[model samples]
Target chain A: MANDVFAKSLLTRRQALALGASAALAGALPRGALAADEKVTLWHGWTGADNTTALNGVIDTFNKGGKGVTVEPTGYDWDTLFSKWVVSSAGGRAPDLVLFHITELPEFATRKVIRPIDDVVASSGLDLSQVPDAGRTGVTFDGKVYAAPLDVHPLGFYYNVDMVQEAGLDPAKPPKTGEEFLEWAKKLTVKDASGKVTRYGFELPNTWATARWIWFSLMYQNGGTFLDDKGLAAVDSEASQKALQYLVDLINVHGVTNPEVGGNKGEDAFASKQVAMKFIGPWEVNLRMAQKMNFMTAQLPVFGAKPAVWANSHCMAVSKQPNEDKLAADGTFMKWFFDNFAAPATTVGIIPQSKAVRENAAFTGTEQYKYFKSFVDDLPNIVYEPLIPQYLSVFSFDKPTPLVTNLQAALSGSKPVPDALKAMKEGLDAQLKKG
Target chain B: MTSVASQPAGRSKARRASAQEGGAVRSGMTLAAYLFLSPYLALFIAFMLLPTLAAVGISFMRWDILGTPEFIGLDNYRQIFADPLFLTAIKNTFYFVFLTAIPMVVLGLALAMLLDQKLKGTAFVRTVVFLPYVVMVSTVGILWGWLFDKGTGLVNYYLTAIGIEPIAWLKDPHWSMPALAITTVWWTVNTNMIIFLAALQDISEELHDAATLDGAGPWQRFVYITLPLLRPAMALVTALTIINGWRVFGQAYVMTQGGPEASTFVIVQYIYLTAFQNFEMGPAAAAGVVLLLITLVFSLAQMKLMKAI
Candidate 1:
C-alpha cells in the first residue's frame, strides 16, 4: 500500500517536472553534489613490488572515499608501455590517463595526441603555486602545459656511511667541494698487495643515461652548457673537456677505480660494497633502503662554479579520447587523481607535484620524508634534456660511442684532449646531419 | 528399319549418361579450396609485400613520427654515401659476418664429423651439443655476458687461478668484438652442426670403403670424398650463417648493447637504433635498402658458386 502511494507520487512529480523546464532545471542544479559514477583506466610503467605498494595505497584511498569515481591501473615496463602507447595512439585506443617521462611529452604534444590540460587546470582552479618552478615548466611545450607534474628525479651522490667512517673520514661532514671530494676519494681508495683496487673510491655506470649525466652535471657545475644558444652541439668547450678529462684521470691516472666496473656490473659492485661511492638518483636510495644497506644521500659535490644537477620528471596527462563519454570520465578521473592519489603516492616517497600536498603537515614530520624533501628542494636548479623529436638520438646508446671511445682513448694515453673532443664533435655533427 | 532406330536410341542415351558424369566431376573445385589457401596468402601480402613496398617508398621521403612525410627523392641515398656511420656500420657488419661465420662452420663441421663415428653415447652427445641452438638468442647472449664477465665470471676466475690477469671481455674495445663473436658461435653452431650431421649420414659409405681399401688415409678420405660430397650443404650453411652473422643483433643488443665504444655494433643494430631510437625512418629505410642489396649480392654469389660446384 505504501509502495503504491510512493509510486503514484513519483509519477505525478515527474510529469509535473517534464511539463516545466524551470522545474527540471531546479532538479538538475546540484550536479556537483550528486557525484556521477566515473571510471578511468590509468596506464603506467611501474610494475613490481614498488608499484604494487604505491598503486594499492592510492586505489584503496579513492575507493574508501565517497567520491563515486573508480580508477583501474594497468602497469607495464617502461619500454613496453611506451611502444604500446604509440600503437594505441595511432589506433585511437588510448587509455584515459597515462604517466610518461617529461622528456617524451614534446613529441606527443607535437602530434596532438595528449589533451592539453590548461583549460582543465583553469576550470578546476588548481593552485600550482608551491610546486617547483622547474618541474612545472619541464612538461610545458610551446607555452602550453601538456602534462601535470608528478615528480622530479635528480642524480645525487650516495655514500656508504660505514665505509666513510672506516676510512677515518667524517660521515656527517660529507665532501662539500670538488677538492674535498677528491681528498675523500683518495682516502677511501683501498688497494691489495699487487696494487689492484680492492674497494673503489667511486664507481660510475658507463651507460649514456648515467655517464652523460655525470659529465653534464660536472660541466654545468663548472659553468658550461651542452648546447649553444642556437641549439648546436657545444660539448667541445674547455669546461666540458675539463669535466671529461677528470673522469678519464680518475680511471687511468688515479688508478683508484677499475675501468671494468664502469660498464660491466657497476650497480652490482655498488650493491656489494665493492665501491664506496656511487653517483645515482634518489630512486636508488629507496632501493638501498629496501636492501637494508646503511647509506646516506648528499647533494652533488660543489665545483665552485655553479650548483646544478641533471634531472628527469614523470608527468601525468590525459590522452585524447574519441568521444564525449570518455572525455567526461577522463576529466573526472584526472580531478580525482590529483585530489586523492597524489597524496599517498607522495607519502610513499614519489615526489608529489600538488602544491597543497607537498606542503602538507602530513609530510613534514618524518625522517624518511626529510631525505627526499631535500631532493625536491634542489630540483629547481636541474635541467631536463631538450625537447626534440630526435632528442633521444643525440643521447641514445649508439650516440655515446664517440664520447666513450674518446674517453677510453684518452684514458689509454692514445689521444690528446683536443683530438678526443674533435672526434666527438665530428661524430655528433654527422649523426645530427644524417638524422 | 526398326533394328537401326533402336540401336541409335541406345547409343544416344549412353552418351548422355557419360556427359552427366563428367559434369559432376568438374564441380569439385569449391569455395573451401580458396578459403584454405587464403590465410597464408593474406599473411604474405600483409607482412611481407606491403611493408617491403612501403619501406621502399618511404626511403625517398623524410618522415619523423610527428610530421607528415616530405618527398626528397635520392636525398636519403645521397646522405647514406656521405654519412660516416653508415660506412662504419658496414665495416662492422662484414667483420661480424667473417668472425662469426668461419668459426661456426668449422666448429660445427668438426663436431658433426666427430659424432658421425660409431662412438658410444652418440645420441646423447648430439642432443647435448644441439642444446644451445634451442635456447633463446637473448638468453644465450646474457649467459655469454655472465660467462665472460671480467670480475666475477667463471672464465676470469679460472684465468686468475691459472695466474693470469682478468681480461675485460666486453668492456675493452679490442676484446668486445671477440666476445660478441664467441657468443655468436655458441648461439649458432648447433643448427649448423645438425645440418652437417644430416648431410654426413647421407654420404655413401661405399666410397669411403673403397678409399680405405685403396689405402687412403683418414685425412685423404675427408679431403677428397667427404668434403666434396658435403659441398652443396656447406654452401647453403655458409650462406645462412653469413646472413645470420651479418644480422647479429640479439647478442650485441642483450650483452653489451653495442657498447664498449660501438665495437660490436653491426649494421642491423645501427639501423634499429636509427629507425626506432632516432625515429628517422627515411634514412633507416634507405640504410635497410642498402643492406638488402648487399645481402642479395652476397647470396647471388653464393648461389652461383654452389651451381658451379
Candidate 2:
C-alpha cells in the first residue's frame, strides 16, 4: 500500500509540471489573445535629419500613450526604398504603411500593391476636402484615393540678403519680372582679372532632374502643357522651344550662370556664397537655417507668361492587407496622424496640406514662416509632373530618355535646341506608344 | 568462447564478420564526405545554377515583375536588334575594350619588368602600384570625378594656372570616354601588373644570363625568351581586361550618368537600365545572354591564339 501511494504521488507531480510548462508556452506565443496589440511596420524614404527627427518624435509620442497599435518605422534612401518596395510587394511581404512620392501613385495603384483608402477615409471621419486640391488630385486615380498627401513642396527662388545689399539692390524687394531679374543677375555677377567668374549672379542647376523641373516650370509659365488633349506628348511645341532657348541663353548668351554648375553643386555654391541667387526647393530652408546663413525666399520671377513653379508631394499609402482588424488599426493610426501632423510638418520645413495647420498661429509664428506663407499663397501656381505610371521612367536618371538626354545636350551646348526637342518628341511618342 | 581447434567454422565466420564491418566503415566515411559537401552543393544549386536556368527560361518570356510571365519566344531578341540604344551600347563597349585592354597589358608588363629587379623600396613601390586595385570602384570613380570637375577640379585648376584652357572632361562627349578610360586603366592595371610580376619571376634567370653571354641585347632577349614564356600570363591579362572593360558600369554611372548624350553608356549599363529601370526583364536577360556568348567566344579565341604563339 505504501509503494502504491508513492507511485501515484509521482504521477501527479509529473502531470502538474507538464500542465504548468504548457501554460507558460501558451503565454509566450505571439498569436491568440496577445495579438490584439498589433505592430504596424512603416517604411519611408525621408533621409533629411530634421525630417527623420520629427517623424521619430511623433512616433514616440504616439507610442507613449499606451495605444494598442505600435508603429515601427524603417527608413531608406529614396532609390533603395523604391526598389525594395517593389520587390517586397511582388513577394507579398509588403509593410503595413509606405511613404512614396505622389508621382509614383499611378504605378503602385495600377499594380494593386496598394489599396484604395475610400472606406478607411469614410469610416475615420477624415475630411479629404480640407486637403489642398493639388495634393488631393495627386493621390487620386480612377476616381478613388490611393494615398494621403502630407505636404506639397515646390521650387522657389532663394537669394542672399547680404549679397543683394552689396549689389546696391533692396534686400526686401527682390526682382519681380524676368527683365528685372536679368538686370539683378548682371549686377550681382563678379569677375576676377582673368575673367573667371568668382561669384555667379544667378545659378540654374544642370542636373537631369532639376533641369527637367526648371524646363517644365518654364513651359508651364508660358501656358504650355506636357500632354495635349488626346494625352500625347506635346513637349516639342513652340512654347517649349522658346523656354528651352531661354534657358540655354542664360548659360551661353547672358553668361551670368556657370555652365558647369549642375546637381547639388549649385546648391553648395549658393550656401557658401559663391552664388548669390538660386532657384531651389523649400528643402533649402532647413539647410540654410542649419548653416545660419543670411538668406531669404521669394516667388520665382516671371520668366515667361505666368508665375508657375514645379512641385511634388509626399503621400502616405497603406499596403493591401487581408486582416480586418489590422486594416482597421491602420485606418485609425492614419486618422490620428493627419489630425496631429502640424508640428512635425513644421519641423520638416515643408508647407503642410492641411488648411487649418497652415493658418495655425504656432506654425506662422516661426522664423521661417514668412517664406512658408509665400509658398502656401502661391499654391495656385503649382505645376505637377504628368500623372502617369511612366512618369518616373521618362524623367528619372535610372532610365535614360531622349527628353532628359537631349535637354542635357542642349544645356551643355553639344546639340542644337531644335534638334534636341525633335528627338525628345520622337522618343516620348515611342515610349507612350509602347505603354 | 569456443577454441579454433574445437570449432573450425568459427574462424571463417569471424573473418566474414570483419569483412562486413570494414564495408560498413567505408560506407560511413562516404556518407560523412557527402555531408561535408552538402552545404556548398546546396548553395551552388540554389544561388547559381537555379538562377541561371531561370534567367534562360525568362529570356523567352515577357516578365515585368508585376504580373505572370507570358512566354513570347524570340520577340525579346528581335527587339534587341531593332533597338538603337543597344547598338550604341555595343559600339561604346567595343570602343572601351579597345582603349583599355592593350594599354593595360603593355603598361602592366612594363611595370612588372621594372619592379622585378633587385632595388631599394621594391616592396613599397609594388604595394603602392597595387594599392589602387584594392580600393572600391565607386570610390575611384568619385575621386576621378572630383579630379575631372570643370570648375573646381584639380586637373582644370592646374591647366588654367598654366595658361591652358579648362577642358570639360566629363561634360563634353568627345572627352568623356577618354576620361572614363583613363580612370579605369589607373584603377585596374595593377591587377594585371601583379599577374605579370608572378609570370616574370617564374621565367628562369639562367636564360637571361645565357643570352647576355651570347651578345644578345636586352630587347632581343625579351623578345626571344621572356616574351614567349610570358604568353600564358599575357593571354590571361588580355582576356580579363577585355571582360572587365565590357562590364564597365559604375564609373560611367557615377561620374557622367551615361551622358553628355549617352556617350559613355556601356553594355552592362544598358542591361541594368532595361531590367530594373524599364522593368523589361525578358530583353534584359537576352542582352545578358548575348554578353555571355561574346565573352566565351573571346576567351576561347584568346586561349587558342596564345597557345599557338
Candidate 3:
C-alpha cells in the first residue's frame, strides 16, 4: 500500500522532471538554466549531530566550489531512506546520488536500480589508486564498481580507562587474543558478597546485531565464509561454530558479560561503569565524548586464528538516471566528494579509507584521534559485510530475523549453540532457495 | 423478523411519511439524501475499499514491487502456515489478548464500582485513574519501560527495598509479555471503566432501594439486579477489548520491540517485517489477509453474542 501510494505520486513527479529538464534548457529559473549548471540531489542517513555537521560542512564547501554544479542533500535514518529508495527507484525516479554502505548495493543493483561508478571514477577525477584494496573490493559487485569507496568503520573494543587502570592493567595496552580477552574480562569483573555482580567485565549484546557482527569477525578470522564455492551453506562449519561458542562461553561458562543488556544499552552501561568492555563501531567515539567520560577504543581482539574485525564503509552511490546529463552531473559531484571527504571525515570519527588522508600529520594529529588510533592502525585487517544481497534478510540490526535471533537464542541460553547454528544454517539455506 | 405482511405495511408507512411532505418534494428529498452521503461514500470507496481489494489481489501474486509480479496462487499462504515464526507470533498475540482483554474488563468494573459510590474526593480519584488513558501509547511505553528496567528502575528499587529480588522484567522471555500487558492495561483500561460506569449510572437508585426494602443484601442485590443489568455493557466492552487486543502493535513495538527472544513478537509486526524488511510482498499480504479474516470471524461472533444478549 505504501509503494502503491509512492507509485501514484511518482506519476505526477515524472511529468515534473520532464518539465524541469526542458525548462533548464529554456532559461534560468533560480537554479535551473546556467547553460552548464549541474544539479545533483543526494539522499543519505547522516542525521547524527557530528556526522550531519561534518556533512553540511562538506556540502557547503562543494556547493560554493564554483564547479557550476549545486548539490542538495537530504537526510533520513537508513531504514526509512532504504525503504523510500526501493519504492522510488521502482517508480523510475530515484535520487541523483545516494549515500549508503556498499553492502546495500546488492539489494539495489541486483534489480539494476543503481549504476556502476567504474565509468565515473576517472571521469569524476577520483584517484582510485589512493583508495585501498579492501575499500575498492568491498564496493565491487559482479565485476563492476558499484560505489565510490568512503570511510571504514570497524567494530571497536571500547573500555573504561579508569576501570581498566584500577584493575591493575595498563591502559595503553589492551587485549589482543581470545585467551587474553577472557583473562582481562575475569580480572575486571567485580562482584558483591552475596554473589551479585556489581560491575560486569563485558556486555553481551543479546538484543541487537552488534554481537552478530562480532561473531562474523570471528568467522572471518577462523577462515569461514557465508557459503562455499558452489553457493552452499558453510556457516555451520567448525570454523563458524568454534567462533560463536567462545562468545557463548563468555555468557554461559565464564559469567563475565552482563547478559541482560540490549544492543545500544551497553554504551550507557559503559558510561556508568556497569560494564568495563564492549565491542561496537567507532561511531561510539562521539557519544562518549559528549558524555565527557574517560573512555577509549581499540581494535577487536582476535577471537580466532588471524586478525579480523567486522567493518563496513559508508559510500556514495549513483542511482540509474533517465538521461546522461543527470548521471554525468552526479558523477561530477561524487568525484568531488571522494576527493574532499577525507579531511572533514576525520572530525566525524571514522577511519579514513584513502591512504593520502590517513598518512597526513593533520589527519593523525587531532586530540580525538588518540582514542581510536587502533582503528587507524588496524584498518587493513578489517573484514567488511558479506557481499550477499539476501544476507540482510537473514540478519538485520535490532530486528528479529533467523540469524540474529538464533544467535541471541544461544547467548540467552534458550537454545544450545550447535542447535542455534543449525537453525541459522537452515534459515539461510531457505532464503537462498527463495532467491 | 419481517414477514410478508410486514413488508406492505413498511412500504405504506414510508409512503405515508413521504406523502405528508407532498409529491413534488419527495423525489427531491431522496436525491438530497444521496447528495449528502456522496462525500463519505466516495471517500470510503477511494480510501478503504480499493486498497483492501488491491491487497487481496496482491496476496495471490509474488511481487517484490521492484520487478514484475508473478502469479503464485496459494504459495504465499502455504509459506506463511509453514513459517515457524508466524506460529510464534500468533501465539504471542493470543497471550497478549488473554492477559489484557478479560483482565481489563474485570479490573475496570472493580474500579468503576468503587468510584460509583459518592465518596469524598471521588472526582479527584476518577480523574487520576482516567488520566493515563489520554496519554499516548508510545509515551506510556517509554515511561513503563523505564519503570520496568532491571537496573536503576523505580520498580526494582521498591521490589528490593523490602527484601524481594529484582526481576529482569523486559529482558526475560517469560516476563516481557506480562510487562507489555501491564503497560497496555494501565494505558487503556479507563475506556472500559467509563463504559461500565455509564451502565451502572443508568441503573436507577429506586431498584436498589426496592431490593433493600425487600430484605436483600447488597451482594445479593448486585448479583440479582446489577449483574444482569450490565450484560449489554459487558458485551460491548468484551468485543472492543478483544478487537483492540488483536490489533496490539504500538506498545510491544515501542517497549520490547518484540524481543527478549521474540517472545512478544505479534502478528502485525511479523506482517510488517515480511513486507518491508524482507520485501516478500506476497507472504506479507497473505499474513495481512489472514489477520483480516481472523478479526472478521471474531467480530461476527461478537455481533452474534451481542444479539443473543
Candidate 4:
C-alpha cells in the first residue's frame, strides 16, 4: 500500500492535480503500472543469507503494493547467473529484470538485448536527483542509461582494533601512506618461538577482486588506468608495475604477510584475527557485523601519488523483449525496486545510493549506518574496473581465464612480474582486436 | 537399494521371456534386438552422435554463441593452435596425465597384487581403497582442498612435523598441479585397482605351482608367469587411465579452478571457458575436437606400448 500511495501521490498526474500541487514529478507512470496484471521475472547473484532475506522482503513488499506487477525473483552465484543469462538472452527467453554489476552493462548493451531506460525514465517523469552521479554515469553507455543503479560497493579498510592497539598503533589513525602502511604492518606481524608466523599483519587473498581491488586502487593512486582511452592494456607502465610489485613484496620481501596465503580467504583470516588489517567489501561487512567482530572500517591508504580505491555498483536492468507488457513490467518493477530499495538495503547494511534515502533521518537513525559511513565518505576516491566486456572473465578467480591467475602467479612468486604483465597485455590486446 | 535389487530381476525376466520365444529364434531375435536397441540408438543419435557431429562442423566456423555462425574454414583451429594459453593448457594436461595416470595404473596393480597375497584385512583394505571412488568428484576435491591448505592444512602440518618446509599446495603454481594430481589419483585409483583385482583373481594357482616345480624363485616366477598373464588387463587399465587423464575436468574444476597460475588448467577447463564462460563456441568446439584426436592417438599408442612390453 505504501507503493500504491506512492504511485498515486507521486507517480500519477491525477493524484498530483487533486492534491493541488504541481504535477512536476508525476507526469506519467510506466505502461506496466497501467496494466491489469504482469509477473516479472528477475535474476540476481545475491544468495548470501542476509542479502537473500532482505531482497525477498523487498520483492514481497513490491508485489503487494498494488503496482499491478508481480516480480518473481531467482538467485544464483555470479558466474552461473552470467552464463545462464547470456544463453537465455540468446534464446529470446531472458528474464524481465536482471541485477548486474555496472561494469557488465556494456556487454549486455552491445548485444542489444537490453534497452536503454533513459527515455522511459524521462517520459514517465521518474525522479533522478536522488541517484548519485557515479551511479547515473556508470549505467550510461554512449549517452544512454542501461540500468537503475542500486548500490555502490567500495572496498572498506577493515582492521582488528585489538591487534592494532596491541601493536601500539592507534586504530583511529589508520595508515595514510604506503611507507606508514609498511611500518604499521611490520609492527603488527607477530612471530612464534621457532620462527613460524603466529599472526600476519595483513593478507592479500588470491581470489575474486581481493587482489584486483587493491591493485586497481594502487594503479589509480600511481596515475595508471587499467585500460587507456583506446581500450588497450595500460597496466604494463612503470606506475602499474610499481603498484603490483609492492603487493608482491608484501608476500616475498616484507615478511609481514606470509608466503603462504590465509586460511580459506582474506575475510576468514581477518574475521578470525589471524590478520590484523586488510581491505574488505560491503558483502562481507554485513556478515562480519552479524558475527560481532571487534573491527572497524577505515579509508584505504594512499599508496602512490593520490587517494584511490576500487569499487563497483549493482544495478537493475530491463530486457528488450518485443512484448510490450513484459517490457513495461520490467521498467515498472525496476523503478519501483530502485525507489523502495532503501528499506531492504538498510536492513542488511547495503549503502543506499539514493540521495533522498541516504539523507533520510530514518536511515541515518540506523546502527548499520555507522559501519557504512566510511565507505560512503570515500565514494569520491572510488574507481571502478574499466568498462571492458572481458573484465569479468579476464580477472575472474576461476580458471583458464588469464588475468587473475597471472595476478596470482606474480604475487605468489610463480611467474616473474614482467612476464605476468606481458601475458595480461597480450590477452587484453587480443580481446580489443576481436572487438 | 531398489535399483540394485530390481536390475537382476529385470534381466532374469527378460532371459526367461527370450527362452520362451526360442522356437522362433532367428527372425524373432532380429526383431527383438531392434526393438530393444532402439531406445539406446535414439539416445545416442540425439545426445552423443548428433552433438559430436555438430561440434566437428562447428570447429570450422566462427560463432559467439549469441551471434550467427560463419564458416571461417579452419580459422578457429588456427586460432587455438596459435594461442599460448592453449599451449599452456596442453602442457598442463599432459603434466596431469603423467602425474595421475602413471600412479593410477602402477599403484593399482601393486595394490591388487598385494591383496592377492591373502594379507590380513584384505577385504577391509579393498573396501577402504575403493571408498573414495564411490564419492563424487566435487566432494573429493573440496575435502582435499581443505587438507591441502597452505597455512593450517593437514598436509602442511604433517610436512612441518617432519622438519620439511611447508609447501603451498593449492596456491603456488609450482605445486598446484601436483596437488591436483595427488587428489585425482587418491579419488579414482580404486577403479583401476578393482579392474586389476578381478583380473588377478582369474589367475589360477597352477601357474605358480608349475613355476615352483621348475625351480624358479618367487620373484622370477611372478615376473615371468603372472606378469605375462596380466598384460591384457594392464593394457585395458592403461588405455582407460590415459583416456580418463585426457578427460580430467571435475578434479581441477573443484580444487584449483585451473589456477594459482593456470598450472592445472587442463584441456576440458579451457573448453569450458571458451564454450560457456567466454561464449566462443567455435574455438571451444575446435579445442574439443583436438582433445578427442589427442586422447585417441595417445590411448592407442599407450595400449600398443603395453602390448609390446
Top model by TM-score, which number? 3
lDDT by residue (tens digit), candidate 3, A138-181? 78889998888878888889989888999999878889989889
| Clashing residue pairs found in predicted model 1 | none
Residue-level lDDT of model 1, residues B1-309, one tens digit each, is 686567777787887898787766555455556778889989999998998889899899998654678999999989877776678778877888878878988998999999998989999999898888779876787677778877667778899999998887877777888888888787779889989999999999999999999999999999999999999889989899877777778887777776766676678877776676656789889988888888888888888988897
What lDDT does the true structure give each of the candidates? 0.74, 0.81, 0.81, 0.81
Worst-scoring 10-residue span by lDDT in model 2 chain B: B1-10
Off by over 4 Å in 2: A1-36, A48-54, A264-267, A272-274, A322-325, A342-348, A365-373, B1-44, B114-120, B205-221
lDDT by residue (A1-435, candidate 2, tens digit) is: 224324434656765675466458876754543333467889998877778888989987785454567788888977678767777878878899998789988878876779999888888776778797888999999999998888888888889999999999997888988888988898898999979888888877555477787788889988889888877789889889988998898888988886566352222667656679988777668778888889888887888999999998888889975554577767777877776777776787778777776788767877878767667777889988889887667777644568778888888887899888888988888877777
* DockQ of all predictions against the true structure, Cα-based: 0.22, 0.29, 0.39, 0.32
* Residue pairs whose backbone atoms clash in candidate 4: none
What are the TM-scores, per candidate, against the unseen true structure? 0.83, 0.86, 0.87, 0.86
Report the candidate with higher DockQ, 2 versus 4. Answer: 4
Q: What's the true lDDT of residue A323 in model 3? A: 71
Comparing 1 and 3 by TM-score, which wins?
Answer: 3
Give lDDT tens digits, candidate 2, residues B171-245: 677888999999998998889999999999999989999999999999999999999999889998999988888
- Model 2 residue pairs with clashes: none
Residue-level lDDT tens digits of model 1 in A88-170: 77677888889878888876776667878887667655555646787777777889887777766788888899999999998
Candidates by DockQ, descending order: 3, 4, 2, 1
lDDT by residue (A315-416, candidate 4, tens digit) is 888887767566666767777776776776776566667877777776677777777788888888889887766665555667656567668778877778
lDDT of 4: 0.81
